[model samples]
Target: MKSKYKSIIYSIGVLLLTVGVLDKLWWLYICTIYTEFEECRVAYLSLFPERFQNAFLLTVIEILLLAVAAIIFSESKKAIYQKKASKILMIISLILFGWSVFSLM
Candidate 1:
C-alpha cells in the first residue's frame, strides 16, 4: 500500500483504539456516579478499603502504557511514510516516561 494510505489507516486505527480505551475509562468514572448496587460498580471499588492507593497508582500506570503503545504504533513503519516517526516517538516516550517517573518521586 502507499505510504499515505498506510499512514491514514494506521492513524484511524490508533484513534479508534484510543477512543475505546478512554471511553472505557470514562465509563468507570461514570459507574461510580450512577451505580447503587455494590456489585454493579467498577472493578476498583472492591479494593477501596484495602488498596485504594495501589489501585490508583496502577490505573495511572495503565494509562501511561496505553499512551506509549499508541505512540509506538503511530511511529511504526507501514509502507514508506513515518520515516522518522519511530525516532521521534522514542524520544518523546523516553522524555514523557522520565517526566512521569520524576513526578512520582
Candidate 2:
C-alpha cells in the first residue's frame, strides 16, 4: 500500500483499541442495569474482577506485543505494497518488546 493508506490503517487500529478499552465500562453499565439477575452479578465479578481489570501493566504489555506482531505481519517482505509503513513502528516495537521482557523478569 502507498504511504497514504497508512493513515487509514492507523485510524482503524485506534478505533479498535478505543472500543476494546471502553468495553469494560459498557459491561459494567449492563451489569448495573441488570442488578437483579444473579447471573449478571456472578458473571460481572468473575469476568471483570479487580485483579483482572486492574492488570494495567500486563494489558499494556500484551497490546504492545500484538502491535509488534501486526507490524511484522504488514512489513514482512512478502507483503510488498503493505510494507510502506514507517519504520517508527519497528523502532517502537523494539523498545516496547524490550520493556515487556524486562517487566516479566
Candidate 3:
C-alpha cells in the first residue's frame, strides 16, 4: 500500500483509540466513581481534575502509538526492519485494545 493510504489509516486508528480512551474514562466515572455526575461536571469544569487530565494524556499516548505504527507501516515497504516493527506495533495495539475493553468493566 502507498504511504499516503497508510498514513490515513494510521490517523483513523489514532482517532478511534482516542475516542475509546475518552469513553473508557467516562464509563469508569459512571461505574466506579464516588462523586455524583453533577458534581463531576462541576469539578471538571472548574478544576480540570487529575482524572480528566489523565484521560486526555491517555488519548495523546494512543495518538503517538498510531503515529509510530504509520511510520513502521510506511518504512516496512522499503526497509528490512519494517517487518519487526510492524509485529511490535501490532502487539502494542492488541494490548491497548485489551486494556480498553477491560477498562469498560
TM-score of each: 0.35, 0.36, 0.38
Q: Which lDDT value does model 1 have at 14?
A: 54
Candidate 1 at 23: error in angstroms? 17
lDDT of 3 at 43: 43
Worst 10 residues of 1 by lDDT: 39-48
Clashing residue pairs in candidate 2 (N, C-alpha, C atoms within 3 angstroms): 1-81, 1-82
In candidate 1, what are the lDDT values of residues 59-89, reduced to their tens digit?
A: 4664576465455555564343564764554
For all candidates in order, the CA lDDT equals 0.53, 0.52, 0.54
User: TM-score-based ranking, best first?
Assistant: 3, 2, 1
Residue 37 CA displacement from its true place in model 3, Å: 14
By TM-score, is 2 or 3 better?
A: 3
Error of 1 at 75 (Å): 7.2
Total residue pair clashes for candidate 1: 0
TM-score of 3: 0.38
Please give, for residues 12-67, the per-residue lDDT of candidate 2 as tens digits.
Answer: 54454444345445556767778576765456556565766444554464566546
Off by over 4 Å in 2: 1-64, 67-84
